[model samples]
Target: MSFKSAFTLTSLFAVTLSVAAPARAQTTFVDRPAELRSGTCASPGEVVTSLANLVITAGDPQGQLGATPVEQSGTVVPFAISDFLAADHAVVVQQSALESTVVVACGEIGGALNPDGTLAVGMRGMSESGLSGVAYFTPIDTFQNTLVTILLVGDGGTTTVAVVDTTVAAGDTAMAGDDTTVVAETGAAPR
Candidate 1:
């Protein structure tokens, strides 16, 4: 081959290899789905109020990832799981009644990621709020976006209740106390 043609071909091959190399490397980590890491928060001391806003941050309370409103029962937070587990993280729940400055509840993110890419952590309430709960981190998508579910319950003689449906067909001869309360009437069978 002519020198000019040979040089041109070599240049093209080098460029092709350079471009493909990064693409291959990118796929190495991309194949693995995002992970989930969670933490729980509670009152540092005695205080009143179960409603608050939840935030995920890099251990520091100021380094926030995202914030979402949380109810007494629970709430869902949308954040990238990989980013959450990248470093030491914390879940902070601030009381809305006190202008959200009071860190009513907080939990440090720890523990190894499960085989299914899920993690759970415990939280403590700030002050004497008598609030505590478990934070469950779950992967909702392949892109690493996690749906953080925070379930909070009072500490003082408060029982966390979950309603389950045990409805059975009439005359099916099922066990006793099989009544079910339909929270919503979607006209669809429970999956």
Candidate 2:
């Protein structure tokens, strides 16, 4: 009730609020740090602006946790085209007990995960201009050794999604889910 008491309380609240804020990172951190060997970029800012601005966890499509972006999967996590940061190519992740990483353009995943064509797997954002970058994804490997699935989003509304059987190994093209053009045959008669 007293002015002094009120001022002290307010100051305490202000101190707490200030402390709650997050601290900035001194340097950039990347899953593929070694791959980031570029003389053109030697600073944190450059690293972020060069490739993979963020990582989305399996479920957390939005970069809630810091600049190290990851795509969280399991629960239909969506990656925004703008978040791709065309200034640099973006790394996509569908992380979980099983983790996978993919590189995509700005508007690659604008809507749902519609691997609609026989070529690619992704969504659309803004106009056709959004998803105009190289599209890549990784199988749920370990922290540093995830495989990249290189494929095109293809014409029409098709996002090429394939299941790569890791057991098949990278060199072998027979691996299922390897982002290949192999189509799965479903039950029922064809016309």
The segments of candidate 2 whose C-alpha lies over 4 angstroms from its true place after superposition are 1-11, 14-20, 23-56, 59-65, 68-133, 136-191
Candidate 2 residue-wise lDDT at 132? 28
Candidate 2 Cα lDDT to native: 0.28
Mind giving the per-residue lDDT tens digits that candidate 2 earns over 70-104? Answer: 22112111222233222333323211112222222
Query: What lDDT does model 1 reach?
Result: 0.44
Steric overlap count per candidate: 22, 37
Which candidate leads the pack in TM-score?
1
Candidate 1 C-alpha lDDT tens digits along 140-190: 657444555565555643222222222323343222221121121122211
Alpha carbon lDDT of each predicted model: 0.44, 0.28
RMSD of 2: 20.7
Quote each prediction's TM-score.
0.43, 0.21
